[model samples]
Target: MKTIAILVFTAFLMISCTSKSNKIIAQKDYDKYMEIKDNKSKDFAQNEINFWQAKYDKAPNQTSYLSQLASNYSKLFENTGDVKYLYKVEALLLQVNKEYKYTAVGPIRSLGRNYISQHRFREALVLANKALAIGEGMKETQKLLFDVNMELGNYAEAEKNLKYLTNKTDFDYLIRVSKWNDHLGDLKTAITFMEKAKEIAVINDNKSLKIWTFSNLGDLNGHDGNIQKSYDYYLKTLAIEPNNSYALKGIAWIAFSNEKDTKEATRIIDNISKRHHTPDFYLLKAQIAEYENNQALKSKNLSEYFNMLNTINYGAMYNKYNTLIYADDKNTAAKALEIAKIEIDHRPTPDSYDLLAWSYYNLGDSKKALEIEQKYVVGKSFEPKLNYHLATIYKANNMMAKVAPIKKELLKSTFELGPTLEKKITNL
Candidate 1:
């Protein structure tokens, strides 16, 4: 009888552990964050913009008011995810740069950042170089150069720029190092560096830095398979900035991907969409609909996404998403190939090449796809989606040996890829 009791107790303990592991997120933890409707940040940004615009109108010669207006518009873009505000900022910054005769590093660097946000990495790099030639803000320009070079896949140049700003105790240096480590696939080291940066953010008590650190930690933790830690970090982000759409989206991802609670995920996304209205949210909703096998809902969301893209002059910002979407349809595969080539010209990153390869694979040229993957995509990118494409291209080319390892790796990334791709990855 004692032996039977011991066995039952062990079984109960195992079951309890399993249950605890499975339940990573609780609605109560994020319910208040979701209920936050008032966008105080956006209100303040608009107020600042109005004040700056009035000043600029009164003193047309004062370029400083233009800079202030640009800053406010950037804040609005950050808070609302509106591309129009971003474009407004870009125009204002360009005017500021022209007024300064491209000699001022401040507006030059700002324009470089704007170009980076627009995915115009080559343009950003040129701006960074121009800033470097000005020699007014060497360290800042080095940092911008590092960022632009990384985006353009100029790793050696990025490393040189990183070396120029190698202050281990500096918050900016720490975050950049963390990004470098992440790019190198040393996730544990990357998280450690980011955690150090988070500590500095806490010590400085800087709201923007804190929000950036917390939200980035959420992403790194999610990629590391620490979904509970990721959820907690996102909650911390929301605690600081209640209207932070990125943090809310992270929680929505946890609900959808880890918990498979599609209804809760959709609810959170819908709430965010009411205010943010970013096109990517529609894509995410469509993905959720696909997972639920709601074809009509999926089609509606995709149509909305495409309509937004068609209406907005987003430049190259959404090219990758457009390429992937078009690559999946037989009728649009040619367009996907065209955009993929444009994306390659824009950045030439391995991920861009993966899009090109995937487009070729979809267009019924596995040999060309394999050639592109071998030259650019293989061993260059560690993204799960890119690896899935690599595996698909390999399988199509009768390279089962290459496909096997990638398939194994992808199976472990089902949570990150979400429920919709689980069967697809399994079948790979």
Candidate 2:
């Protein structure tokens, strides 16, 4: 009888731990955020854009009005994930730069940032170099160069640029440093730096900075397995910007990946899509459908996503996603390879290399994939998806010894990889 009691208590403890581990999301904490509300922030941005646009129309030579229009358009893009707004901003900035004959560092830097958003890293790098040569706004241009260099996998140059902007207390410097540490896989240090940046944002009471810091900390915390903290940070972001799709997506991810509450996740995502209408949201919905074994729903969502991509020429912004999707299908594997090479040409980042390697692997050229992985991806990137591809490629090459440690690491990253990949990782 005593032995039976011990077994019962142990079983209860195991179940309790399992429940605690799974119960990371609380509806009450994020339910208010999920409620649709009047998007005053977006309205204000549009009003600002209209005001500036009217002023620019009245005095076409007023470059300041053009800049204001571009800035407001960027804010609108943030509030609503409308790619047209980004293109509008890009066109406005290009006009401004052309008017200035590409001699103005301010417009050049702004255009560089716009290109970065479009994933045109090489063009951004060119703009950065032009701004650097202009010898105005040297510090800001250096920051832009650092960002472009990092995106282009010019790590040595990125480090050099970072060293030039070495102000530990500066918000921009701290955030970039945090990113660098994260790229190096020192997530704890990354969080520490980001927390410092968050303190600066709170001290300044800068709404935009606060939103950026809180949302980024939410992502970093999620990556670190601090799901509860991640959810709270995302809520904080929503408190500041009620229409922040990114924060809402983070909460949806917590519901789907950590709690396995696909229905609730779908609810949040569907709500966001009603407002934002971004392509990636459809991809995420497809992933959830795949997880739930709803093949028809998955196919529908994927078809919708591709249709949207075709309808809207997003330029190279969706290349990575397109590459991954194409690589997964036998018929489209060659198309994936073509897109992957284009991505590499645009930005030879380890992540891009991983896409190319994955394309090769999908085409049954595992040896070629192994070569690329060894040369570019093995330790150059630490993204969970990249690591998963590396492990799979290693296994394909019969490198079981290399696959074991990565599989162990990836088991802890199921939440980041999402529910669909959880079983795939387990099989690995």
Candidate 3:
């Protein structure tokens, strides 16, 4: 009964759900769209507009149906990054504002989302507030309001709404709480909630929720400086659903930061940029080029990067690498080392230490690497790659006595202890 009431209220809030005839149409379009909605798939989400439209055409008096159609179309624009589609959304949103402004929740939240997309947080907040003022039953309006307030840096208001929604105690509410913590720099809290979302996805057998949680986990790992952990999470997400451009971006970032493999990094980012043209894609490409001896590519990538002003990590890596390259000349490298050290002072986690140690090592000093590797090798020794590097480094400089311990670790590591490999390890 409570479930029924909630669903009814949610439908009231969204302004519509489905009639049998429309449900048939929506189901059909969804099936067709899914075929094309690859990870890079935007058209599927767009075609949903058509499904909703077909429903509205069958029952034009159903303002709720039209409202949903407009929202669907608006989201297609958001998902695809097509301004023309958003221009379509702009008109559709206006239509909802006109025909059903009295009770249409769809256009309200849709407009807020579109405004946010345009970086018009002020406008977005207004629309979101208007939606909240109107009596709607679902938490989505609250969620959008929370997000808009957060975007405007109204963290207190955002926290109030977020707490309300979080207390709903449903799977959707849990996911929302995770995302809220994610943006607030509380990554550990984000992961804690996201893990609950992951469990909910598994219990409900919901692919969308699974993909979202995995990607959120990936983002959280990246924030914590677990670059490889971030990469692996993204890959897990991709294994479930490819064409996830964001995950693909994570791949480029992880490769660059963790492996420092420019070749592989460039290839991955370049392919994604060909399709997406996101600012992050170009910035990563520039970073990879910066590492190369090729001046032409470096210049091109830097030009692309500079054209993007609001990038995170802008100038940080470039400054670090430049200093590392010319550490002695103007003592630029020494200056850069100091900068890295200052950053580490603020966040002395494994990654900060690892980066600091590597910068020092690149300055022809391995002493720092030796110091930080102890922190980095934290139970990760079961992996073939790092253990090998650490063990070899230990073998060098007459530290071979440490080899036995590492070999023992390598043998005990997860990768080496598979059921099939157990006999082999035993024989060895």
- Candidate 1 positional error at 309, Å: 1.1
Q: Which ten residues in a row have the lowest lDDT in candidate 3?
A: 8-17
- C-alpha RMSD values across all candidates: 9.3, 9.0, 14.7
| Per-residue lDDT value at 157 in model 3 | 83
61-133 per-residue lDDT for model 3 (tens digits): 7767765765566545434333455556656677777887546676777777766555456777778778878
TM for every model, in the order presented, reads 0.94, 0.94, 0.58
**Each prediction's whole-model lDDT (CA):** 0.82, 0.83, 0.54
lDDT of 3 at 118: 50
Off by over 4 Å in 2: 1-20
Per-residue CA lDDT of model 2 for 1-428, tens digit only, reads: 01101111111001100112557677787677666678988999989988888898899989989999989898787667777988999999999988989988988998888888888889889999999998987878878888888888999999999998857699888988998998898989999999999999999999988988887888788778777788789899989988877778887877777788999989998898888787888888888999999999999999999999899878998888889999999899999999999999999999999999999999999999999999999878878889999999999999999999998888888777776787998898
Q: Which regions of candidate 1 deviate over 4 angstroms?
A: 1-21
Output the lDDT of residue 245, model 3.
Answer: 53
Which residue pairs clash within candidate 1? Answer: none
